[model samples]
Target: MPELPEVETVRKGLEQLVLNKKIKEVLVAWDRIIERPNIEDFTNQLIGEKIDSVSRRGKYLIFHLTHYDMISHLRMEGKFDYVQPDTSVTKHTHVRFIFTDHTELRYLDVRKFGRLTLLPKNTAMDYKGIKKLGPEPTPEEFLLESFNQQLKKHHKAIKPLLLDQTLITGLGNIYVDEALFKAKIHPEQTANTLTFDEVTRLHVAIINVLAQAVEAGGTTIRSYKNALGEAGTFQVNLMVYGKTGEPCPNCGTEITKIKVAQRGTHFCSLCQRIHL
Candidate 1:
């Protein structure tokens, strides 16, 4: 799944590639990928619409068109490519937005899990998944005080609590492990038990780690690529997410992997000691 940073990268790429391109035609090879307005309505309504801009919230992409907002979620295996009209269509290609300029923006998903929904103008933010998201993991939005308050109310394991997207948005398994390791907090630590100092460290770590990941264009784990079809470079900067049995960067302790809430978790046991 493309996490926040990966989605953000895609938004930037789309902004560069597809902005202001009037849709001359929309082809849907797979009907189920359109989640709103019925296939016929969706295809008809977007006929003359121009892509004004592209924005993002959490892992969702918002394509601001001339008359409506198209909400896109690139669930696992979903990707977009801008190409010529004569480009060969692959078996996984699902949606195509051919522009008046003769260029084409195609969406392909091997797993067919991605979704595209069309809604009224300026109403994309009200969508249920986006409306309920926690603030973007930035210093300005994810404040320390609110995060501290939220942490005190959760008794679940810290890793799962963070992954819930209620405490903070944009953190998937990869960034969570990296942030916890950077904060020196164990994955299994109870949320409410974190001391004030620990919480402060975690707050800074989350913001910094995510910022770095975004700067690096997100981690390219598996087959993730931005709309430009470029793989991310942050995977090489990863400290603990997939460094199992490797020596910790700070201390020489070997990293360990465990299952928390059925998700694979990685951390350095000596670096991230459990509070209990």
Candidate 2:
């Protein structure tokens, strides 16, 4: 799944490439990708809608059109490619948005798990998935006091609680592991057991880790790439997400991998200790 940073990267790329380009036509090779309205209605309604801007909430991308807000979720292997009209449409290409300028924004998903929903203009935030999001992982929106209070209400293991997107949105398995590692909190630690000092460290860690990842264009894991067809560079700076046996950067201890809430989790045993 493309988390906030990856989704934000795609939003920025789309803003530059597709803004103000009126929709000449929309082609859907896979009908299941359109989640809202009938396929015929979706393709027909977008015929003259111009791409005004692109925004992101959590892992969802919102394309602000002239008459509607198109919410897209790139579930697993979904991605968009901006190309010319003559560009070859691959077997994986499921949705194609042909612009009046002759350029194309093609959505390709190997797993076919992506979805698109068109709602009234300015109503994208009220969508169920986006409505429940905690907040963007930033200092301005994600405050320490509120986070501490939320932690006190959850006895769930910290990792899964964070992954739930109700505590702090935008943290997937990768960034969650990294943030916990930076805070020196074990993934299995109960959320309510955390000390205020610990929570403070975690609060800062989440914001910093996500900000840095966004700056680096998000971590390129597996098939993830921005709309510009560029892979992210943050994977190179990762400490322990995929490093099972590597030396821990801070303590020289070998990193460990374990399953928490059925998600693969990585942390340094010496650095991150369980509080349970």
**What lDDT is obtained when candidate 2 is compared to the true structure?**
0.93
User: For each candidate, what TM-score against the reference?
Assistant: 0.98, 0.98
lDDT of each residue in 1-276, candidate 2, tens digit only: 788889899989988888899999999999999999899999999999998889888999999999999999998888899998798889999999998888999999999999999999999989999999998888899999999999999878999999999878999999999999999999999999999999999999999999999999999998899989899999998999999999999999999999999998999999998865
Off by over 4 Å in 2: none
lDDT of all predictions: 0.93, 0.93
Question: Tens digit of lDDT per residue, candidate 1, span 1-276?
Answer: 898999999999999999889998999999999999899999989999999999989889999999999999998878899998788999999999989988999999999999999999999999988888999898899999999999999889999999988788989999999999989999999999999999999999999999998999989988888988899999998999889999999999999999999999999999899977
| Model 2, total clashes | 0
State in Å the error of residue 129, model 1: 0.4
TM-score for predicted model 2 compared with the true structure: 0.98
